[model samples]
Target: MPATHATEHSITVAAPPAVVYGLIADVAGWPAVFGPTVHVDVLEEADPERGGEQLLRIWATANGRVRAWTSRRVLDPAARTVLFRQTVPAAPVASMGGEWRVESTGDGTSRVVLLHDYRAVDDDPAAEELIARAVDRNSHAELAALKEAAEQGELRDELHFVFSDSETVAGDAGDVYAFLDRADLWPQRLPHVSRLDLTEDEPGVQHMDMDTRSPDGSVHNTTSIRVCFADRGLIVYKQLKVPVAMSGHTGRWEIEPLGDGTVRVTSWHTVTLDPEGVRTALGAEATPAEARALVRKALGTNSSTTLRHARRFAEEARARA
Candidate 1:
C-alpha cells in the first residue's frame, strides 16, 4: 500500500450543529462563502438509494492560481456528515477524499471537522509539499468562513439576485466564446463601447476597464474582474466599479451548443441594488419597480448587443466559408 498524505483540521463554531451543517451540506453555494472558490457547477445530484454519487466541478484558488477539478460527494444529514472524493484530482495529487463532520458540544457550540486523505502522483517530496500547503490553506479558509456564516444566521443572502438574458445563434457555440474572449476589440466592434482595456495578469484571470454608453447617451465607466473557464465555455465576473444605481454586480457568460448545429449564448447578472442610489439616479419619485426596470434595460441592452454581434460574426464566418 502506498503511503497516504492525510490532514485533519477542526474549529469550534458558536452555532448549532444543524446551522453549521446547513452551510456545508449545499456544496453549490461554496463560491459565495469561500473566498478561494470562484465558481461551482453541480453536475450530478446524489441518489437516495445505494448511497449514490453527487458530482461537482469547482474552480478554486490554489497557491494563488485558479485550479479546477471535479469531485463526487455523498451526504448524510441524519449523521451531520458528508463524504467527498475528487474524481479528477489536480496535478500532483494521485487521489483525494475527505469527510466533513459537525458535532454538537451540548454547550451552544459545535465542532466542525474537515478531514482529507491523499497520495501524491509521484514520490516527489517538493511537489507533494506544494499540494499539501494548498489543501491546508483552502481547508482553513473554508472552516473559518463556515463558522462566520453560520453564526451570523445567514449564508450569502446579501448577494441579492440572479437574472439572465440569452440569445439563440444559428452558428457554432465555440465561436461565441471567442467574441467574449477578444474583449479588447469590443470598442471597435461594438458602438456602445467607447474605451476599453483588458489584462490577463495571469492566464484565465481577467481585469478590465470599460466605458459603455447607455441608451440615453450616458456613459458608465466600470472596472471588473473575470474568471474565465474556457474549456467549459463559461466566464464569471464581478464589477469592482459599478453604476450609480447599484452597490455591486456579478455575472457570467456561457455558451452552450444545442447539438443541432445551433448555439445559445447567455449573459447572467446578480446585483445588489442600493435604494439610495435609485433616488439619486432616478429622482426621489421613482418607485421600486421603475428602478428595477431601469437597471434591467440598462444592462440588458448592452449584453444583448454583444450577443447579437457574436451571432453575426459566427454566421458571417460560416457564410464566407
Candidate 2:
C-alpha cells in the first residue's frame, strides 16, 4: 500500500453547506473562479447524487512552464464530501489526491475542509515538500475565496455592459505604440493614476499595474497584460487582476490608421459577477447597477486618460519627425 500523507485546511463560510457543496461540485468552474494559476479541463461530469464520477485534467504552471495531471472524482452528496484519486496520466514526479468536505455548522454557515496528499514517484521528501508548499498556498487562497463567495454572495451581477472611447493622434504608429506599451508613463500623465509598474517577460508581452483613485477618493488597483500588435496598429489589454466583484473581466484595445495623419483607437471590455456570491458578501440589498458602475468608472477613466496621453505623445513625436 502507498503511504498516506495528508494536509488539512478549513474555512468558515456564511452560506449553507449545500450551497458551498454545489459550488465545490462544479469543479469545471474552478478556473474561472480561481484565475490563471490553475487550469481545469473537465473530461466528464456525472450526477453527484447518483454517486457518479468526474474525470478532469488539471494543468498548473510554475516557473513559466506547465505541469499536467489527471484525477478522478468519486462524489458522495449524502456525506457532503468528494474524494479524488490520481490516475496514470500524472507526471513521473507527481501523484495527487484529495477530499473536499462541506459541513453545515447549524448556525447559518458552512465549514469547508480540503485535505490533499501527494507523493513523488521516486518517494523524494524534498520534492514532495516543494509540491506540498505550492499546493498549500494555492489551496488556502482558493478556499478563502470560496468562503468569501459563499458568505458574501455573488461578487458579480447579471447585467453587464462594454464601453469604449478613443482618439486619433498624429505620429508614427511605432512611436505611439512604444509609448503606450510602457505603463510607467501613467502616473506622470494621468492624475487619477497613482502608481504604475510594468513587468516584461517577452517581446510584445508585458504585465502592468495601474493604481487609480476612485471617485470616493479610495485607491483601486487593476493589473492587466498588454499584447502589442504593431503590424495592426493595435494594443490589447485583458484584466488579469481586479477587485472581487469585477471577476471574470476581459478587455481589449484596437488602434488603426485613418489613412490621413492620425491613428484611431478603441477600447472595450466584458464583465461577469456571481449573483449568489455577491448577495452573500454584500447582503441581499446589493445592486447589480452599482457593481456595473464601478467597472464602468474604472475603464472609462483609464481609456480617456490613455487617449489624451496618446494624442499628446503622438503630437510630440510628429513634431520631432
Q: Which candidate should be chosen as best, given TM-score against the real structure?
A: 1
Model 2 Cα displacement at 149 (Å)?
A: 0.5
Which one is best on lDDT?
A: 1
Q: What does the lDDT read for residue 250 in candidate 2? A: 57
Residue 158 C-alpha lDDT in model 2 = 45
CA lDDT of each prediction against the hidden true structure: 0.82, 0.71
Which stretches of model 2 miss by more than 4 angstroms?
1-4, 35-37, 48-51, 61-66, 88-93, 154-240, 243-288, 293-321
How does residue 171 of candidate 2 score in lDDT? 67
TM-score of each model, in listed order:
0.69, 0.56
Error of 1 at 95 (Å): 2.6
Model 2 lDDT-worst window of ten:
152-161
Candidate 1 lDDT over 86-193, as tens digits, reads 999887778889999999999989999999998888757887898899989999998987887777653235324567889898887667888888889999999899
Candidate 2 is scored at a TM of: 0.56
lDDT of 2 by residue, 218-257 (tens): 9888886666667766665556666666556655566777
lDDT of 2: 0.71
Give Cα distance to truth, residue 34, candidate 2, Å. 2.6
